[model samples]
Structure formats: structure tokens, C-alpha cells
Target: MALESLDRSPPPFFRVGFAPLTKLFFFSALSVLLMFGDKQLQFTKPIRAGLSTLIMPVQWLVLQPGQVASSVGDYFQNLDQAQKDLQALQLKQLQQSARAQQVEQLLIENQNLRQLLDLKNTVATPSQVAEILFDVPDPYNQRIVIDKGQTKEVVLGSPVIDAGGVIGQVTRVYPLTAEVTLLTDRDQSIPVMNSRTGARNISSGNIMSGTPLIELKFVPASADVKEGDLLTTSGIDGVYPAGLQVARISHIERRVDISFARIHATPLAELKGRHVLVLQPTGIQAASKGKAP
Candidate 1:
């Protein structure tokens, strides 16, 4: 009667009858079998592929709303940013336009003065406006590639100048672009003169503390060169025209122990930013009689 009553009663729902070690052994065996089958038999391939295919649609459906929301949010954010940027660009263009008018007026006056002096007006050569694509990757080269190339009549050895001063020379030409060697590269040299005293010297570039600085070599110790004296190209090389501004004397060091004094010149051109107006060379002969205004 007692056994019958026990059987008739519901078995305890939370009873723990299995031996822990036995259960662990069984699970371990099952896992080992699964891993071995997966590695050696390739038994899971079809199952896994089927499961992947079955769940793919569901997974995509689950993510659809989030994806759509993210896309919409990004589009709106980008639109807002673009609008702000456009307004800022427009304002900058207006300021640049005003400044350009002033520059044009100055150029006109200079042309008139050249004409009156009966001097060869340094003919503005045909030029193509190009954007600097990138800085030269090699630190030793100190160059940049402009978008203008043979298609634009950009030739090698053409002098590249900005509004401030000479930046570099075009050294290599490609089908679609050209490379400009900056004035501050070690291999480059420019014939420069002290604007205040007409003393001629060669400026060579050297890197000091990772910054480009030009050292004026062969300058006489007695040369009247001083800090802040402006230096302009003498144009003796025929590569760079005469009277183009190059740099300003920044430091003059004269040591009795050294035969040559070390002179440093700060480049007039801004090396860190983009510049406008790279003058192309015209093969035309320079008229001998014209004086620069």
C-alpha cells in the first residue's frame, strides 16, 4: 500500500537523483564526440550551412530597423554639416574676392610703371591654376605634386612662386602633373642678394630641428648683412628671374675660429599652407631694358 501511494503521488519536481560525476562524464563524452566529429568527419558542414541560411533572413529582419535609423540619422547629420561648411566657404570667398581686387590694382600700377620706364615688362607667362595634391612622402625630397602637367604646358625647371615669394622649382614632369622642389630642400640652391646692400650670396637649405632654414654661404664676414635684412633673388642663374623676393636674414653668426660666417634666412614663402599663383616659364626672351617697378 505504501509503495502504491508513493507511486501515485507526484514525484518531487526538483529532485536531484543523477550522480554529479556520471552526469559530468556523459557531458564530457558528448562534447568530445562533437569536437572530434567536427574536426575529422566534416559532419557539421551541411548542418551549419543550413542553419546559417535559415537564420540569415531572420537576422537581417531583426537588424533592418536599426540600420534604417542609422542611415537616416547619418544622412541628416551630413546634410547639416555640409550646409554649415558651404556658408563658411561662401564667406571666405567674399573676403578673398575683396583682397584679389586690391592685388589686381597693384599689378596694374606696376605694369604701367614698367611701360613708362620702357623696360621689358616681365610678361606674365601662361599659367594653369593647380591644386597641391599632396606633400612628398620622402622627408629628404621636400617636394609637392601639383595637378597641372604637360596637358597644361607645365614644364620642368619652371619656377614656382607664390604671392609671398618663390616656393620652389618644378623638377619633374608627368603626363598629368609635375613635382615642385621646395627652396628649402638640401639639394636646392638659390642665388640671393641683400636688398639693402646689393651683396650677392648663395643660399643653401639645411634642416635644423626638423624646420627648414637657409644658410647663406660664402658671404664675406664684413658683409653688411643683418637680421631682418630682406633677401631677393639676383636672377644670375637665369632659372629664377631677378628681384624676386626670397627670404629675410634672420641670424648672422661670425666666429673668429671659423673662416666662413654662418648666416640664416627665413623663407618669405609659407611652407605649411597652400599657396596661389605658380608662375609658368615662357620661352620668350627677356627684354634687356625694362626696370622692375
Candidate 2:
């Protein structure tokens, strides 16, 4: 009967409620101690390091799939963008090729005009069409380099022109390229003429602020010159051929004290653009004379 009573009474540990309460108090104290140690001291460094080392392989395993997916997505996007850029570049090249053909036709017509005038057969020198690689590295100089050079037989002193007018001349040459000094450069000069009256003048460039214009020196004050007259190369120097455009007169100031009149000419061409043509001087025409007995 006593054994049955003891069995019916709860087990010894459950009979004391304080035993479970003591275990709960001990667990809570352990958690608080761990939190305080982590926050206030480096006592858990070794444990943290060990746990990090153990978790590294798991982390790598977890991220591998996401990384591979991201890489594949990025590669495909880059490929698509590259294809689009290539298509755009090809379309631009085709358009430039068509425009080049039109320029060739115009050059042929210009040669025909020279033939009709019985002037020196202005042979448009066979030039290698070169792309303007970059502007002159020096900020003070207004110059540019082209793709053609000694390799392409690009000679020094070749006249550079554009659709509008003369832009510059090739001054320096290298193995794979050449440099062109623009007409607006301070040191550059050209022999020009009044297109309306055929009066010869020398044009020089100046770089002063608010007055960036080519100065026409040695223009006679008595010469019947007017504003807005076109200036073209005279071809006397044998560098640039006759009838090629140079610039247009912008301002003319005549002073009684000064013998020569001051004149400013605005270049007809845009110096910054890529398009340009290099011209070589056509040989001088032979003059005919009456029979000398």
C-alpha cells in the first residue's frame, strides 16, 4: 500500500516546484551573461571566429547558385548592348560612305570647270581620305592630326580644305599620321584675293579674345574694297591653287595716319568638324605667245 501511494505521488523532482524554477533562473542568467560579455568585452572572440570558420563553407554553398545566375544575366545583357552599338556604328559608316561619293562627284565637276576656263588642269591629287584622330594636344595651337601620313604619301604643305572653304595646311608629318595647322592659328598665313574685285591681299590669323578674326594686311586704302566680299586663294605662292575659297571680309577700318587699311576676315569653314579635303597644287599652265620671226 505504501509503494502504491509513493507511485501515485509525483516523482521526487516534480514534487518540488522550486527545481524547475531554479533551472529557468539559471538559463536566463546564462543568456544575460552571454549578452553582456559579447557587448562589453572580447571574451567571445575565439568562439565567434570558430563559428565563422565553420559557417564559411555553408555560406559559399548558399551563394554559388545566385552568383552564377547573376553572371549569366550580366553577360547576356552586355552582348545585347554591344550588338546594338555595332549596328548603330555600321549605319553611320554607310551614311558617310554615301556622302563621300557625292563629294567625289563635286570634285570631278570642279576639275571640269578648270578645263573649261583653259586654266591649268587642276588635278585633284589622289588623297587618302583620313579620319581626324584628334585635335592638337597643345591648347595654344589650333591644329589637328589625320590618320594618313608618310605611309600614305601625305606630303608636308598639303592644303587642307572643307566643304565651306580652306581650313588649314599640313605642316608636320610622321610615320602613320600628319598634323594640320588651321587657318585660325596665330602663326599661319595665306595669300588671298577679293572675289568681287580680284584685289590681292595677305590674310593672317589673330587669337585675341572677342576679336578672333583673320587680319588682311597690306590692303591699299585706295582699293575699292567693301564689306562682305569673299576672299579666295590667289595661287601665286604655288601652295594653294587659284579659286579655292579662303575667307570672307567682315570688317574694314581705314585710318588716315596708317598707310594700309585694317581688315578682318571670318573663315568660311568650321575648324572643329571632321570633314576636310587635302589639295595639292596643280602645275602652272604654259603661256602662249605670238610667233616671233
Candidate 3:
């Protein structure tokens, strides 16, 4: 009986008061109340800010890989855009350079035309401007076709001159186009007078030489011809006007065995120009041609 009474009742300090669910509800309500109070009263905000500031570096470190990847992606996109812009700018620069060069060329041609115009006014023979239509396709000959022909009173045997001097003579005339045989042609010949001594010399084209050339034929070894002596039209053939420059003696060689000296001359007129003047003598007239079809 004494053992049963001792085990039947426990001490008050050891007694169970409430169920586990009731304790859980009480603590949960307390936690919710604390959170609401902290939010409403602005409590713990400074503490939160301090904690965030302290861990910022650690947070940044943890996210560094993602940031680096994003930065690398942006860098590649920017680089690609820069390369495309650079290529477009380079192409635009090339186009601008081409336009600038064309403008420069046109300016130079205009200056040349001005000089030719002044020369035309000073000369007595009436003339007209003619542009080179095209080069004669025969690779062996140095000849060009002019836009002016019988339609423009460009006659056969008409003298063609440039700013420098005689360039060629009209050999063939069409209704609206003409062929000018350059002085460098093998079959062409001109009568030139020595400006120094008034002596006559026949100028013939040099075909054997690779460069443009004119040779004086049958000039006696003792002839007064010298290097740098200017030659002009003698007007003996009436094809070219008098006193117009034809060639200048560049070199003279006299052989003891030969009777005449070999004379080489350089033409003053440059054949590379696009524009030329056709001179019409006062007495000569081109026959009117039938209208072009």
C-alpha cells in the first residue's frame, strides 16, 4: 500500500500542463505579433541595413559568375557592332575618295580647255573644238577619231592643232566623224622649216622606234640643224598653217660614211589630251555632205 501511494501521484513540478498543439499555437501567434510590430514601428530596419551592408561583398562574390557572364555577352555584342560600323565607314571613305579624284581630274581638264581657248583666239585660222571620240582600234597605229567631220566642215587634209602645236591632220572624213592621223604614223609626212636658218626639212614618222618619234630626212651633215632647234610649218603643202610648231630637234647624229645626218625630233603637242582644235584655212572649204541617215 505504501509503494502504490508513492508512485500513484507525481510532484507538481513534474506535471504536464498543456498539449503540444496549444503550445505551438501560442508561440506562432507571438512570432507573428513580433514581426507585425517590427514592420509597423520601423524596428530592426537599421539592423537589417547594417547586416546587408556587412554581407554585400560576400553576396557580390557569390553572384560574380553570373555578372561576369552577362558582362562578357554585352562586350561581344558591342564589339560586333563596332566592327560593322568600321566596315561601313571604310566603304564610305573609299566612295568619297573616288569622287574627290574625279573632281580633281575634271578641274585639270577645264584648265587645259581654257588654255586651248586662248590659243584659238590668237590664231588667224577659223577653227572648232573637237573631242576624241575613240582610238583607232588598230594597235599598230597611233590615230584617233574625232566627233567633228563633214557635218561640221571638218574636211580632209585639215590641220589639227592643240594648245602646244600641230597634233595631226584629218585623213578621212565621214558625215559626222573624221579620222585624224597622228604625226607618229609610219605613212604620214610633213614639211617643216627650221626656225633658225629658214631651211626646209621633211618630217617623217618613225615606225621602227617603240616610242613616239619624227625623223628629218636627207638633212645634210653640215646642215645648220642643232639640238633644241625649233621646227614649224613651212606652209609648202598648204595643209598646215604657217609658223605653227611641229617639232623640236632633240638629237642629231652625223656619220662620216653617210652623206646626211640622222635627225630625231619630239613633237610639242601632247596626244593624250581629250580636246583638240581643227583649223580651217581661209581658201579651203569642205564640201557639203548628204544628211546623215
Candidate 4:
């Protein structure tokens, strides 16, 4: 009875202010009233805007890692695409270079053919066109092979000439090709006449020891030969036609000890021609015509 009376009626510190249900109802009504006033008055807009502004930099910082990863991936993809495009462009450039070389070669060939045609109109003798196939394998002799042969009626000893002048003569004939001995061969000689004066001499090839020159062998020191005088075929040798170009006098040397003059001439024909004209032997043609009824 003493313990119950000590506590039950007891401490002022344990005294109550309000009931728990009453406190809960009063706070709930206060919150509803605040929400209704805020909606009607629109007073919280500036506060909401300030709060959003404060959160924006943090939002950006949070997204930075993902954005950097996407940028790195895109950079690598672009670099790979650029490398592929550069390779493609390089391949195209190589193809264009090859085609351009072929076109330039074709233009040069066409120009040579046109010049040959013009030369053909100027030739008076019966002639035929032939393409030079290749140079002969013998290095000692300056010779070349042509595409015309026995089937083309390319006779042995036929005179071969280029646009500028006489180049060679057909020395060997095959069924489909022929070998031409060029004028610069060591064993070749032609009877040439000076066009300025009527003097004549035999011009032999490679006479100055180791040079591509024709030496007028029998010319006297007192002969009327001058440097730069043009030489043409004398027509006495029935192999070549008269007045066809042969060479030009390049140098003249005379010694009191010798009776003959040492004369050197440069052949006017292009020895490295791609195309040539083969003239019918004048003697053979004349003989055939003579035998004709």
C-alpha cells in the first residue's frame, strides 16, 4: 500500500500536457492548411527555382564519366574511318597514275604514226611500211629486225629509210620477219654524192676507230668538200634511189703527210626509229620492167 501511494499519485515530472491522438490531429490540420495557402498564394515558386539551380551543377558532375566514355569511343571510330578512306584514296591515285602513263604513251605513238604518213606521201619510189620489231642480239653489229618478211615481199638488199633519211638495208629475210643492217655497221658502205658540188665518194661506217660516223674514205685533201655539206645517194649503185638523204659532213681533217682527207659525217636518219619505209631495189624494178612485154 505504501509503494503504490509513493508512485501513483506522484511526480510532477511525469505530468501530461495533451493526449497523443489530439496532438496528431492538430499537426495534420496545420499541414493541410499550409498546403492550401501555398497553392492559392503561389509563394513557393522562387524557392523551388532556387533549389533546382543549386542541384544543376551536381547533376552535371554526376553525368561526366558517361559523357567522356562516349566521346572516346566516337573518336576511335572516326579515326578508323579516316584511315580506311585514306587507303581508298591512295589506291585510286595509283590506278590513275597507270592510266595516265598509258595515255601519254598512246599520244606519242599517234604522233609518230602521223609523221610517218606525211613522209610516205613525199616518197616517189614504190615503198611499203614496216614496224621495227626489235634490235638484233649481236652487240658488235648495229642491226634491227622488222615485221615484214618473204610473205610481205620484203626482198633482201631492200633499202630501209625513216622520215629523215636512209637508215639501213635488209640483210636477212625470214618467212615473217627480216633483219636490217643499219648504216652505222662496221661492214656497211654507201656511195654518197655532195649535193652542193657534183663530187662523189664512198662513205664507210665506223671508221674513226670507235665512233658512230661515216668517213669519206677516198676524198682528196684538195676536194671541194666542206663541213655541213649535205650528201645524197649518187644513183650509180643500183641499190639506192638517187637524191635520197644519207649524211652530212661534220668534220674535215687534212694532213700534209697524207694525200687523202679524213672526213667524218653524221647520218641524218634516226637509227632508233619505231617505223621505217622499205623501198624496192631500183635495179630489180628496172630489170623487171625491162623484161616486161
On residues 44-75, what C-alpha lDDT tens digit does candidate 2 reach at each position? 99898999999999999999999999999999
Cα misplacement distance, residue 230 of candidate 2 (Å): 0.3
- The order of the candidates by lDDT, greatest first, is 3, 4, 2, 1
Badly placed stretches (over 4 Å) of model 2 are 1-125, 283-293
Task: List candidate 1 segments past 4 Å from native.
Answer: 1-126, 271-275, 282-293
Predicted structure 4, TM vs. truth: 0.70
lDDT of 4 at 110: 72
Model 3, span 189-285: residue lDDT tens = 9999999999998898886878788999998998888899999999877677789999999989999999999999999997656899998853373
> Which is better, 1 or 3, measured by lDDT?
3
Per-residue lDDT over 127-166 for candidate 1, one digit per residue giving the tens place of the 0 to 100 score = 4446678998997778899888888877777777655677
Residue-by-residue lDDT tens digits, candidate 4, 240-270: 9989999999999999999999999999997
Question: Which stretches of candidate 3 lie above 4 Å from their native place?
Answer: 1-24, 36-58, 281-293
Residue 159's lDDT within candidate 2 is: 82
lDDT for each of the candidates?
0.77, 0.78, 0.88, 0.87
Candidate number achieving the greatest TM-score relative to the actual structure: 3
Q: Which should have the higher lDDT, number 2 or number 3?
A: 3
The lDDT of model 2 is: 0.78
Give RMSD to native, each candidate. 22.4, 17.7, 6.1, 6.4
lDDT of 2 at 99: 95
Scored by lDDT, model 4 comes in at 0.87
